[model samples]
Target chain A: MRVQAAIEVAAPPETIWELVSDPARYLHFMSGITRWEIAGEHARGLGARYRTLMRVGSAEIGGLVEIVECDAPRDLAWTSISGIDQRGRWRLREIGPGHLGERTRVELRLQYGVAGAGILGWIAEQVAAPAVRKNLRRSLQELRRQVEHEQARAAAATRRAAARN
Target chain B: MQAQTARASSGDGHAADGDPFARDFDEHEAGERPPAQPRRGPLERLVDAAATVIRGRVPAADLDERDPDFIRESLPAQWLLASLWFRGEVRGLGHVPEHGPVLLVGNHSGGNMTPDTLVFTLAFSTYFGVERRFYQLAHNLVLSWPGLGFLRKYGIVAASPDNAERALSSGAAVLVYPGGDHEVHRPSWERNRVSFDGRRGFVRLALEHDVPIVPVVAIGGQETALFLSRGEGLARRLMLDRLLRVKVLPISIAAPWGLNVGDGLGHIPLPAKITIEVLPAIHLREQFGAQPDVDEVYAHVTATMQETLDALAAERRLPIVG
Candidate 1:
């Protein structure tokens, strides 16, 4: 099953990049992306791997994954080589100006393979497409909300701090 | 007579026009002529003609100077949408106490610095009925427009420790966007992407002023504005791109990027709604001089801001805007 969902992030790409590209900060922003620990010694850059598990409703699905690409604040893409037939990519493209803040068009693309590689794969793709798309959409939106809220909080702190100085 | 009987508009009124239904008929008091049934039009019979003239036909430019929302909504709201528009589902607005001077410290994105500030100001004014001016500690460039006209007009002083002290000292509700330039271009969507290295400004100011910090979490506001790609070098050929504080991209990214000055900022902003939740006021008394570790206070406040944001995202419906 292949599905894609994106969220218009008011945050700058750099802000989103800090949260999404860092393997350690996954739990800090994303909602259902659980079980992100190192698979090896490397923590950042390409070829670094992480054992990952994502929560889908009541079910938990994951596999060992390796980073194929990592471009800070711009692109982070990965493929599942050992898990339950999973593929994930996080892409940040400048989409135009945002409504309230600056907007970064965040596209999260995922492809899932069913048990069979042929007809059954097609069936599974249809069945899982909506579910996975919905999940990814919600997750990206969650990430957006978290960053912007933090942005506001940071602003307040700056104001207060500036006051003292 | 108009001055003696004239009433200052009360509450957050829409406008001063009397309801047409409020027309009265009482010409018999001064004349042998029977009074005309007070038709809702101009009655040569009364003294409120001035009020009526000031009513529906009132010019937006003439609105009370302190209440800018009227002028904003009346004349500029539509035009403002031509560039960018925002719709925030403000939650926990009541957490902002209406009693005394309160300091609102919040996270701000570099791509869209002023969104959170504007939304917070509207929410506060709408709920509190006071035209509370949120003193913004803006950058020097934003104030130095042309010859610093905009700043002088709107009363935005530079962001400094002294300005913060002055605003808080005057018992006014002030707001600050602390992320500065770095936070603006940071990671795309991470909430805790980066920390303010020397971020003790708010904490120190609050402790010094003895004011409570009202922590606000503006979630998903950054989804609307975007920074496509940064240039290879920070060239210093200053112009409008730098003036507007947006990077000059070689390629167009945002929806309205190619549009002109009057085009409706195209619907690139997905329907993801914005939810602004006001968390409990964080008190500085316990650790002002007690904790002694400014780093500890910064970490604590930062964590709280993140926690509040996460909770809101998990619990509330996501937002969608212009």
Candidate 2:
């Protein structure tokens, strides 16, 4: 099954990517994520691998995943190296202009299924879709909130610095 | 290992009390057992032959029979049952070693259906992908049951020390329930207890193999049915211990067959929410002396498991609703 959740953030794509690309920040924003740890040497870039787990229903489901596509400030995609077969992508686009001057549209897309699971697999996918989709949607909301909050803090800090100068 | 396997094969399932797998290990280990049974009638002889034939049908513990592909395919079905019906929640899986031969000792419950086994197997397989070699020791009768051969593909072998040694030697995590049939068929009132029935063979197995022991405690399986009694007296009177090596003829009030006897055919387990906690691994030599006393280790293991089971029991606001 495929699930996607999107949100508009006040910061630029670069700002959002900074949080999404880093494995360390997943627990801070990703809902239902129980674990996300670097499995190999590389921490970032296309070849980096991470051991990931999300609590859905009765199991902490996920496995080693490698970053397949890591385009800075725009897109990052990962595919499973083991465990449940899954492909995940983070898509970011710079929206023309909002009240906040510049905004980024961030979408988290995930497709997961057991390869030869047949009819029950189909049913399980459908039953689990809502929960997985909710987690993604909440994760994006949390990401947007964090990014926008940080931007507001920086702007305030800049205003105070200018006044002091 | 070969000698142990040979001795293990001598008795399919005829151990005395406190012996897991009903094997003759206790007789060999301690040299004390119940006296030999008297001469048998024609009916008793026939029953013994039938049981022998059934026991002969048990497949040899070939670790190669574990089919990773088959296990992967069947996981969805197990997931559905565990998620929707049992509402299984497994915690502390990280306590199991990342990769190695570890002994997972769990408390058995839910009688023949064994919902805990179903839930834990799914959790473990999903937690550590299907490629990892993992085996679970089951009662001889379960393996001998007709139409249940598919279980072997899931890496289930007959409960025997030699089989466990093979799985561990191959560096696969082996799961064993020291309680076996005795505790699994206990009365429901004692559901919250962790009763291994004074079995310490698991500790010896771990010490001999030099593997870490991880205690897996689970609750709510007993609520799956209204277990009335283990029927030890009845089984003894019927000579089932001699003929089939079955120590208990459990009686319970279960669905599809009220006042169910034997539970031989199994029954539909109630939708009881199962919660399993995997305790941190215990390195026997590290925790105890280099040459640990088997009795002391057994006591410590059972006590730790009992404490965990108590905590799990305390968390339940209701029985099956948990």
Candidate 3:
């Protein structure tokens, strides 16, 4: 099944990419994520691998996933290397004309299922769609909240620094 | 769960019924069998012939029979049963060793239809991908039952020391429930208890294999039906222990069969919320001594499991709603 969730963030795509690309920040902003560990030497960019697990229903479902597409500040995608078959992507787009840095639209899409599992697999995917979608939506809201809050904090710090100077 | 029947196969060309493990463990535990009543009637002969056929159907333990592809394909059905039907929640799977052979000792519950096993199997399979060689020990009866041949594909072999040793020798994790049919058919009021009935063969198995033992505690299965008794007396009088190698003829009040007896045909288990907790692995040689005492290890394991079961039981405010 395919599930996607989108939200508008005040910061630019680079800011969102910074948070999403760093494996360390996953547990903080990603809902239902139980484990997110760097599997190999490389941490980010193409070829980087991660052992990820997400709590869906009664099981922690995920596996080793490699970064197949990493377009820096715009798009990031990964496909499963083992465990459940999955393909996940993070898309970031400037919200409006000439307001690229001021606002951005972020979407997290995931396509996951057990290949060759037949009718029951199809049914299970349908049944698990709502939970997966909810987690994605919450994760986006959390990402927006953290990024916007960080930007506000940085702006306040800059104002205080200027006044002190 | 008292599927204490020993290895059905002696690895010889002879019939499995003549196997020593089946006779030694099954009959020794049940005591002396009563004298033969009379000559078999026509109905009795037919039933005997059918039993003989079923007994012949039990397959020999072949580690290669465990097909990871088949297990992966069947996981969805198991997941639906565990997630929707049982509403299972499993915690602390990380406590189990991530790799290598280890013994998983669990308390069995939920008569003939073991929902606990179903929930735990799904959780284990999903947690540690199907690629890992994970096997479960089941009673010969369960293995010989018609249409359950697919269970072999799920990596379940007849409960026997040789089978377990073989699985472990192959560096695969093996799950065993010492309580077996005895504790599984316990009265509903005693659901919170972890009664292994002094069977410490699992301790010996782990010690022999030189592997760690992981205790798996679960609750809410006994709530699936109103279990009345294990019916040991009836089984003794009927000589089921000697004839079929079955110790108990359980009686319960369950769905479709209001006054279910024997439960050989199984029954519909109520939608009980099952919660399983996997305790940390106990390296016997390290924790106990270089020469660990079987009795001590058994006591420690049972105590630890009972404590966890108590905590799970206390958290429950109701029976099947659990």
Candidate 4:
């Protein structure tokens, strides 16, 4: 089953990219994720690995996933290496600077299927897809909130620095 | 006189407008105001008022009204004992999620008077604050005592499926000792062992609630008293199990009480200098398959706790002194 969600964050794409790329900070902004920790020495970008546990209904489904694609400030993707078979991607696009603020459209997509359960897998997916979509939406909303907050803080700090100078 | 008349007319108009009963009265002056819907009994009204007050004081769904105040008052003394006398060291508290429900599974030690339980409860309530809704599941007998209203106030509920479910549903971190009295009363020589008496209800609870299971491993509790035997056969012969739901009738050497049998009444717990290590959380469905085997989950949790306990034991050069 595939589930996706997007949000228009009032921040630059680079700001959203910085937050999403770091594995350590994933727990802070990811919804319905019970665990997301670095599984190996590599921390970020391609080749980095993470052990993730995502809550699906009354169960947590996840495994060791490795970064398969990393396009800085634009896109990042990962593929499952063991446990549950899955792929997840994060896409950020600049929606052009507006009079109100700079807006970035952030989209998260997850494609997952149980490796060995066959018909049971299909049934489980059918039951869990809606929940997964809701989780995705919540995750995106949290991401937007975090990115916007970070951007605002950064802008305020920059202004302070300029004033000090 | 004209202004007073106008004001009186307006007042009457406002009264008629505000009261629907008055409108009905005007429509049917003959019909008596529908008998004030049977007034609730005084006892029921008082009960409702008390419930409202309790709910306001204790916002958590399953917590007792006096829990926050009791924990605050007891924390200072418990902290002093934990830090100074017991030299209790807590680690990996960061592994606990900042929010949401979680199951804290640990091996229970130190017969009836568990210093480890006290130390952990103090540390947890201190770290998370009393408002975060944390409950410790204890045997029904523990909560049965009349004077232990203090225990209830500190969110110690009787270990039952219903109680556990209520705590979890309320998004409280529930600390459970699957070992129960059996492991706590094990011979002191077997202090390093992490035994749950093969209880797997904790795993089922975690799976049912879909919460992360954080294994809490503590050593030195068993060293508080010199446990001679579990006396399971004795308890069985005496029918204590059937009569009181008491599984273990432990014979232990302790201060004051030379030989303690069925230390359910509790004894003076020697300060054993407990060290608790909280292990990383394990999601059952994630580690194992979606339909994970209960035995497998139990084994995984106990093994992890055992390994950590062994490591902590290795660090202690002397018993009780640790």
Candidate 5:
């Protein structure tokens, strides 16, 4: 069984991508991202995997999530390895200009599989899916608040700079 | 777009209560949506066309994006204006769009189901060059009211999947509440702890129909005419809430900032100028190409809503919080 959740945030792709592209800030936005760090083996790029721990309710699972694709300010995807099955990705698009010039639509998507190789597995997935879905949305909303707040700070700084000049 | 739709593998539409898409009330309620007027004589068609033209020309009230006037004309201004005492300041006239279909999805509020929406529409009509209809995708219960013929006429459509899909595809900017009514009724005022479910139908429609999604956040909406309790069990059963389609405070209850009953509408709040921050657009990933996985589609859209909301909130109390 696979579960997914998503929302549109109102910051430009560049503004949002700056935060998502960085491995340093993953936990700041995602609620269940227990452990995350750049793998010394490779830089953040295609095929580069980052080992991280995630929580599904009380249970914890650790996995090496590899970046299957990475198109800055556009698309990013990852799949879990050596842990509870899961795959997630974030994609940003220029939906067109938003209400004020500052907002852009960024869609973040998360998907996970229960690895139900049998009936017992299926039963476990039934119990776990809803909780994970809620977690995914909560995580995404956090990402939105973080990114937009960061951008607003930048915008305010820019205005202040102009004022000083 | 096809790829994006395929990627959105959300496991929704399963439960009766959980999935808005699968929210099938009953045959009687389902019959409440629209099928448009039936075929008519050439003169009748001409009359309809002329009416559309006239409504298009009339100065409209600034309503919420999903106010439903996208399909028909029912912008209720004189009524709400007469009811509430609005004396708030307006500063961002330069921000609203001058033309075209605009989506006005603001913070869900205490101004009844579509009161603030109607207020927004009225303001848009007053300020913008052309009077535009702000279509609001309201809950099914509000649109299902009778005295509210004013309801159907003003284009307040149900928030069901099918109705929302139809409204947007027909060229209207569909306004939605991922947080739904629950967000407005949050018990504490310490900033809502909420996120939208994996309902990507609106995002898919925006991609499929190719309309821009604007993020609107209105401050002071929930605080006004406030109804804060999340009534449970017996209090709810006899609270006259369901019949009203909105929660109401007890007759004797007072508000936080020292308010009492016996006021004009009881919960009718003191006049306040609601400032709305209409943030920039969330450009649908142009590459999604019309059909992408549902998961991917949902991801892209949800992120934008979250980001926009935060930006609006941060910008709400500008000029220093002294």
Candidate 6:
């Protein structure tokens, strides 16, 4: 099953990138993910792994997933190494200046397939599709909220500094 | 830290010159006619989202749902008794997972007034905090008692596959006594023994849910009373198993009620200095093969618990002392 969601954040691409680039911050934005922790010593960049557990209906599906692709301020993708078979990607695009100025468009895509269960796997995928889509949309919404909130705080701080000087 | 200091200063209409951002923020704040509402950070937002998800996913009828206020209110009394009266000492709590579903299998002791259950429950809830989901499976009759709303509030649920499944599905740490009434009512002479009465349901529950099994071995509960026998024959002849789902009609000697039979009405529990030790989690797929045999898993769990119980028993210098 494949699920995709996107949200436009009123913040600079660099501002948004600061959050999405850090694998540890995924827990702050990811929805339906019960557990997301760095698997080993490597914290960032390609080949970094995370021990992830996703809520699928009544049960939790867990796996060790590694970063397969990573491009700062642009794209990040990961594929499962063990347990459940799955892949996900995050794409960030600078959508130019908007009403709020310096806008960034963030998109998330997830594709997953259950292995070896045959008919049961297909049924689970079908059942899980809606939840996966909901999670994707919620995740993007959360990402946008965090990026915009940070931008507001930074802007306010900058204003205060100018006034004091 | 910088932001926090800046915010604190700005609230007082003063900005520290050390931070350039603090100066401009103060002017922006002063220029605004209306006070700005405090903005919740990403961490706070994430916590709210998680709480919402848990509330929505966990069923209203879920037996494992905990009332934080009630648990908090009862903690003082329970803790005092556990520490002062029983001298209850719990070890190996680190073996339990900080999060995620887990099955805690332990031997039931002290018949109807199982102090082991109380001590462990109090300790577990206190350590994990009341917000974390936890459930203790008990016989249906226990839940049938009137005016015991406190039990249900504390996440005591009727022992059944559905209840267990619901609790696990909701990602609760479920504590199950596979031995049930039979093990709890065992003769006083078998105090040091680890007995689950050959029940293997707990093994299947862990495998089916793919949760780690945490073994909790407790001693000294049997010393709470002088148990004569499990009264299995009496229970069988009376068809108590079929009617009440009670497998034992225990005979025990206790104050107020000497030669207490059935212990259905409850008895005052002797402060036997209960000691509970939790062992490392046993992952079924890792320990046993993927397609693990039920008997082998059962034996492994029971044997491990027995070994730990024997060790704890050996450490005791005298009855009700340690």
Q: Pick the candidate with the highest DockQ.
A: 2
User: What value of lDDT does candidate 5 attain over all alpha carbons?
Assistant: 0.49
> How much does each candidate deviate at the interface, measured as C-alpha RMSD after superposition?
22.1, 0.8, 0.9, 19.7, 25.4, 18.3
Per-residue lDDT of candidate 1, residues B128-201 (tens digit): 43345546555433433343333232335445454555667767776765554334434444532333434456
**How far is each candidate from the true structure, as Cα RMSD in Å?**
25.0, 3.7, 3.6, 24.7, 24.0, 27.6
Query: Tens digits of per-residue lDDT for model 3 on A57-98?
Result: 888888889999999899999999988899999999987644
Clashes of each: 68, 1, 5, 0, 73, 10
User: Model 3: runs farther than 4 Å from truth?
Assistant: A96-101, B1-55
Q: What is the C-alpha lDDT profile of model 5 across A85-128, one tens digit per residue?
A: 56778877776666756555555566554342354445555655
lDDT of 4 by residue, B165-237 (tens): 7788989998888777777788999999987766666777788789999998989888888999999889766
Which segments of candidate 4 are over 4 A away from where they belong?
A1-165, B1-62
lDDT of 6: 0.73
TM-score (C-alpha) between model 1 and the true structure: 0.43
Candidate 6 residues B1-322, lDDT tens each? Answer: 0000011122121223443333332332244323543896676566546544433332334553467666645654565567656778777776899899999998878878888887887777645556678888776556554555457778887565556677898999998887777688888999888776666667777888899999999999999889999898897676564345455688899756998998878888787989899999999999898988878998999999999999998999899877
lDDT of 5 by residue, B74-163 (tens): 212221341234422233433445444444444455433223454454444323311234455554334333343344444455455555
Of candidate 2 chain B, the 10-residue stretch with the lowest lDDT total is B1-10
TM-score comparison, 1 vs 4, better candidate = 4
State model 2's lDDT.
0.86
Two-chain complex of model 3, DockQ on C-alpha atoms against the true structure = 0.68
lDDT of 3 by residue, B110-215 (tens): 9988888888888888778888899898877787777778888878888876687789999999988878878889999899999888777788778888999999
Location of the lowest summed lDDT over 10 successive residues in candidate 5 chain B? B1-10
**Worst lDDT 10-window in candidate 6 chain A:** A54-63
